[model samples]
Target: MDLQQRINAFVQLGTFLREISSESISKTSSSKFHNQIPQILQAAQNNNRWFTETNIKFAFASWGHALTETTINSWLSSYSITQKIPNTIAIIMAGNIPLVGFHDFLSVLMSGNKVLAKLSSNDNILLPFLVSFLVEQHSDFKESIQLTEKKVTNFDAVIATGSDNTARYFEYYFGKYPHIIRKNRNSVAVLTGKETEEQLLSLSDDIFQYFGLGCRNVSKLFIPKEYDFHPFFEAMFNKKEYINNHKYINNYDYNKAVYLMSNIKLLDNEFLLLKQDSGYSSPISVVFYETYEDLSELQTKFSEDKDRIQAIVGNSGIAGEIPFGKAQQPTLWDYADGVDTMKFLVEL
Candidate 1:
């Protein structure tokens, strides 16, 4: 099928999802499109999957809804069609969260290449189920996509995602091919101290959505030294019902223990942890904070770590847009590591 046809297929998939009830998506019995998360989690524990079931659901929902056709088309249209499409793409999926490798998958397929997908054991459910739905909608997509349970080789190009450690392995193994090896990244927020109460409440979505497991989740905050964190804490407190889930409580308990044992000082309220740090990507529900003297200095610091940052949150007047609620729901132009993936694919 042509690229436009594929785009339409995706649009239909989104429509199909919207038509189904949340109960249907979460249901387990006799459903063609069921997410077999428990089984997938067990398999991942015994195999190569490195993420959790929660990660998978969040990634799929975020990308499926946020990355729309208009966005994809705009990116693709920016590239010159004189370049020939690559023939084969080996996509090494990241199990850090669910379906994190889907943008790579979409890029490869849309570029008219055959896709050899290495599923993260942690996310075995969503990708296969989504691909199945695509094939059910358009059988030709089956020819474009292939699932591999074995290690991959013999591809013209590669896109692999993993922690900073696994990135080296991907590089050494797939370096000969034209490849993009994505490493670890975290998101941060910069509070201008003039942010509205409305913005702070909106910012809470970026902090707590998906339990702060995705890379786009704001794990660090940049605020003026004199800025009082009380309003932010109060906002989070209002959303206490969100953390009433047993899973978040368990994470809070576990992380709280490690923090105390390690003698880390944290400003703890009822639901979140605000500690001091100069980095990004903290553990789930834990956020690091640092005071910046000026936006220029913060911008310079951000540029230095640009490769490791996925998105920047907060009310700072910066190049990246401020995302509210889930960090994973990035807009079309919200390239990972600031790379225009669709442009890369279209130019291939």
Candidate 2:
């Protein structure tokens, strides 16, 4: 498809997503397209423990706001896109969060690159359905997307997202091709003692969303020395229902028991567990924290380990940091792993 046709297809897809996102919270929509959402929700939950109804809806809501024509246009404005000979790009998706690798899929296609997707077993259904929807909107898309489960070959370049262990295999296997291979990374929040209750509540969104599975989810906190845990715990109390999810509660119980048996200190609020550690990647039910006497020193420490960090959430002017409550809502331009997929595709 041509550029406008490609843009229009995604715009229509976004409109369809929005109708299901905010208009009806109980899957009560009468639209033909909206009716399938419940089935998709069921399949997603059946396939992956982390893909709850609320989490899938939240993912769609973020994408719904992002896939607008205005936002797409603004994102593409910085690039000098031309009608180049398209090449196939293989995508190895990670199924940690709902529609986790959709951004890479969107980038490759919008940049005039064909896709050969090896869908993650945990998330194989939704994106293919979306591709079919795009095809229905523009038949030109029919030839552009090729979803498969076999090994990814017959592609000029690749973009793969996986854990730190899998990244080594990807590098060894796909290194010959131009590629962006991602590894384990986590997000952190920097807190000043003066944060308002509203800000702390928003910070809870960053920590609790997706059950803290996503790379953008705040898994660690950087606090000042002698910070009180009462206010922060109280603000995050609204998310107590998280324990209702059996999988999450299992992690909470298991991790909490381990901490107790090991004689480690932890601040607990029944649902979430807080331990003081220097690591960026925390467990599913635990968030690690550390004290920083100087904000500048902490900033410098994080800057040196940027490869291990996905995002930094704070109110301070800590270079390239994300504001509170915005970690999960990345723009099309906020490339994951700080690698510009658009630039990679256009250069291909």
Compute the lDDT of residue 51 as modeled in candidate 1. Answer: 40
| lDDT score, candidate 1, position 2 | 77
lDDT of 1 by residue, 99-128 (tens): 667778877776667799998766676678
The C-alpha RMSD of each candidate to the native structure, in angstroms, is 3.8, 1.3
TM-score of each: 0.85, 0.97
Candidate 2: C-alpha lDDT = 0.90
Scored by TM-score, the top model is 2
Question: Per-model C-alpha lDDT, please?
Answer: 0.73, 0.90
Best by lDDT: 2
Model 2 over residues 1-348: C-alpha lDDT tens digits?
788889999999998777677745436767666778778888889999889888888888889899999999999988877898889999999988999999999998899889999999989878987887788888888788999878887899989999999999999999999999999999999998888899899999999999999999999999998898889999999799998999999999999999999999999999999999978889999999999999889889988999999999998667888888999999999999999889888977
lDDT for residue 301 in candidate 1, whole number 0-100: 83
How accurate locally is residue 83 in candidate 1, as Cα lDDT from 0 to 100?
Answer: 29
